[model samples]
Target chain A: MTFSDITIHAMAERVITYTGYMARWQPDARERLERAAFDLFVEQGFASTTVPQIAARAGLSTRTFFRHFADKRDALFADEHAVPDQAGRIVAEAPDGITPLQIVASGFDAVAAAQFSREKSYYIARHQIIQSDDGLRERQLHTQAALVEALRSGFVQRGSDPVDALLAAHLTATVFSVSIGRWLSAESTEPLATLLRDTFDRMLRTAAS
Target chain B: MTFSDITIHAMAERVITYTGYMARWQPDARERLERAAFDLFVEQGFASTTVPQIAARAGLSTRTFFRHFADKRDALFADEHAVPDQAGRIVAEAPDGITPLQIVASGFDAVAAAQFSREKSYYIARHQIIQSDDGLRERQLHTQAALVEALRSGFVQRGSDPVDALLAAHLTATVFSVSIGRWLSAESTEPLATLLRDTFDRMLRTAAS
Candidate 1:
């Protein structure tokens, strides 16, 4: 039978749509606003993009836009809130016998598998936008610090020491550097999960060596 | 036989000098600009203090003050540049056969021994400043990120995986949270080095647990 005739087709489609909602984002007013904001940010840059213009492009009033996002900078950094929850879910569900570091690595794998593929170009653009503004970069750093704190709390709940919890959280966050390296390389055919895992393993061996 | 007398005399001299320096700092010089800025920041408040007032307090021209620090905020963050070099030295000189986590922990220990004790009040004030300002807190996060990078490089040079190096660096940095906690508590007369060693031992055991 053809692939479409198989029972797995519907399940695969459901997964694709679900994951792609994370990857490409779902259809919503926020998506529309984001699209408009992204275009404005890319064209005139984050510093110059006015809220009224973004609202106009999104077919919303300035007041409505403000209801959704605090400002233009907020539009430029909309993905942060979802990341920690996704990571937490994955870590909480990892197979038994894995180390905290390994569990975090797996959490990263799940988050990346859900979000990275279609998000790449958008993320690169987002990175550029953040880099162009010192304040935005500072905010990004704050977001990361919060992420580490959240992950540390998770580890602490799992019976890790306060010190080890913080350590595991920090180590897990370091995977971002590796992810950036892989994303920027031309030969990166491997999935983000595999990249994160391999990077963690190699890093451990390197430390042991 | 007279070691106690010599130690007491040294302690008395340190108290005298520290008090003198605190008094001698004026409300207007480039040489002691950071100290003056810190004083103003603590007295009036970081956000309320202007560059001109900070320069005037230090006994330096505003331009000269600018030459010393990028801005008013820079004065509150004067320790970061020198911290990494001292930390690197400690890492390089760590006792042989220690685990990488222990090596990193020792580096912080050395830093605490050399710098932390004398500046405890300034640090507490700065910590308060950062806690009050979101921007300063973000700068602090950036400072931590840079330290992580430096420690990672040190590990990699000693032949670590780029990933694990980052993890080790991050974990080591986390000990700062615990150390800071102990420092603020006003109990625990344990040396920072001992506290860090105990922390590492505790983490190792927990990870195994």
Candidate 2:
């Protein structure tokens, strides 16, 4: 468990068991790992690619690969893997009396503005890789499901009714997902946060018959 | 590539041969297998119960179990597997001039009325099993996501905007999921269909504010 004593398998298990963190010890290492995995995934299919191969291609140790991703399947989703924690912080600190949905809106707006604004190409590539395979798409769904659970817990912590909290969580995720789909598909000058807020507002407007 | 997979492949071959011999003699093999799997899942937990054990407990072969369900994760969701086909039929034949939400409402109402109306206890058990295991719950979410895809495509087939179709699909899934949560948690004589309808209505009312 210590930095001195870790095996590749144990590191992989730890990644699966958590939204793991890495020190800012080597930021570029994360990108190296990502780029290496992306190239491997393109050369071979996702199912055929292995973590050790990715690590080797990246010129990093398997220990370093484990720090950035939960598994080989998660290497392509590094940015998304970080969203629940980032959004949860804002949800946890929102001012009182606003709706759970409103809190979720603020949380997502902050995330989109901070992270999604400049990651257009990265996300588009992820979308293509994920869409090409059924298992990857299901993994994507599970990833989003995890995000919903995080939002639901955050809303519950803020004293919303559990049912309302779950509903709000799903709404927030839908807006985030649909906005990303639009953002990646278009080459508009508008910011992702603007598209996300617009999607949230429009979804609410269209919720009724 | 693992020893376990080789064993499973050998078991599957044996099962296919055994299933044909047993089908003529064991008319209730599927039901018996389901009952055995359900009991084992309840007693030993989902992760611990294996397909071979369920087959042995049922006095059936693993092939018979596979014939009825796709895998151990799917054993508890036998009823849900039939839903997309059932609802897709209705969505495919809806009248024009109605909104996508209305199409979704009708589709869900048909599904709930036809299948979910009297299966309260069955669903409660499935919910308990699924909620107890993170993997099972994620599988359940995937099942729902498949239903959304069915709904979305059905809407698109009717010439609805793809974005509108997708948003309506998520909205419908949210309603379907929330209704099931409400239906199972409380002891009420009200039918599942009625609860589903009410939840859909209430979600729209709350969605805008």
Top lDDT model: 2
DockQ of each: 0.20, 0.42
**Compared with the true structure, what per-residue lDDT tens digits does model 1 show for residues B26-133?**
433444788878788889888877776665565455666666789888887878666677767666776666656767754655577776766566677878878887
Worst 10 residues of 2 chain A by lDDT: A16-25
lDDT of 2 by residue, B132-159 (tens): 8867766777688788888889989988
lDDT of 1 by residue, A2-40 (tens): 553343334434444444444344347577778889988
Mark the regions of model 1 whose C-alpha exceeds 4 Å error after superposition: A1-27, A91-99, A117-119, A185-187, A206-209, B1-31, B59-64, B89-109, B154-167, B176-178, B185-189, B202-209
Candidate 2 runs further than 4 Å off: A1-31, A64-70, A73-77, A92-97, A103-109, A131-139, A156-159, A186-191, B1-28, B62-74, B106-109, B117-119, B131-138, B186-191
Candidate 2 lDDT tens digits, A136-169? 7777887787889999899899887777778888
| Candidate 1 residue B72 C-alpha distance from true site, Å | 1.2
Worst lDDT 10-window in candidate 2 chain B? B8-17
